[model samples]
Target: MEDQREIAYVESVARGWTMEDGEDLSAMRRALREVRARALPMNMSMDLIRRTAEERWSS
Candidate 1:
């Protein structure tokens, strides 16, 4: 259940949407932090993040 929620949050972020009322901001921030941390190891750029978000939204 938590996994599904996290996925939804990621998809929402990818789609360039803001968090709606009652959404978990902390969790979303944590998720983003985790993504950044992971991406850091790969030397991923902000452009890559934007592209990834666009791709996720399109899919």
Candidate 2:
């Protein structure tokens, strides 16, 4: 049903927006720091990262 689907979507978004799992959020902070560290040194944009990662992964 549409209502059930909407409820599921809202629940998923709520879960992401909240720390119900006792998540420390440090992993995300560390990942962001790593991204900034790499990007700043190379002047990389989001597109560059995506393309580079794709090429590296595919080869």
Q: Which candidate should be chosen as best, given lDDT against the real structure?
A: 1
lDDT of each: 0.63, 0.53
TM-scores for all predictions: 0.34, 0.31
Worst 10 residues of 2 by lDDT: 2-11
Rate residue 33 of model 2 by lDDT.
Answer: 83
Residue 19's lDDT within candidate 1 is 57
State, as a TM-score between 0 and 1, how close model 2 is to the true structure: 0.31
Local accuracy of candidate 1 as per-residue lDDT tens digits, 28-57: 777879987776544457778888999898
**Cα lDDT, model 2, residue 56:** 92
Candidate 2 structure quality by residue, lDDT tens digits, 1-59:
44542111123644644332223345555676898776644545666888889999986
- Which pairs of residues have clashing backbones in candidate 2? none
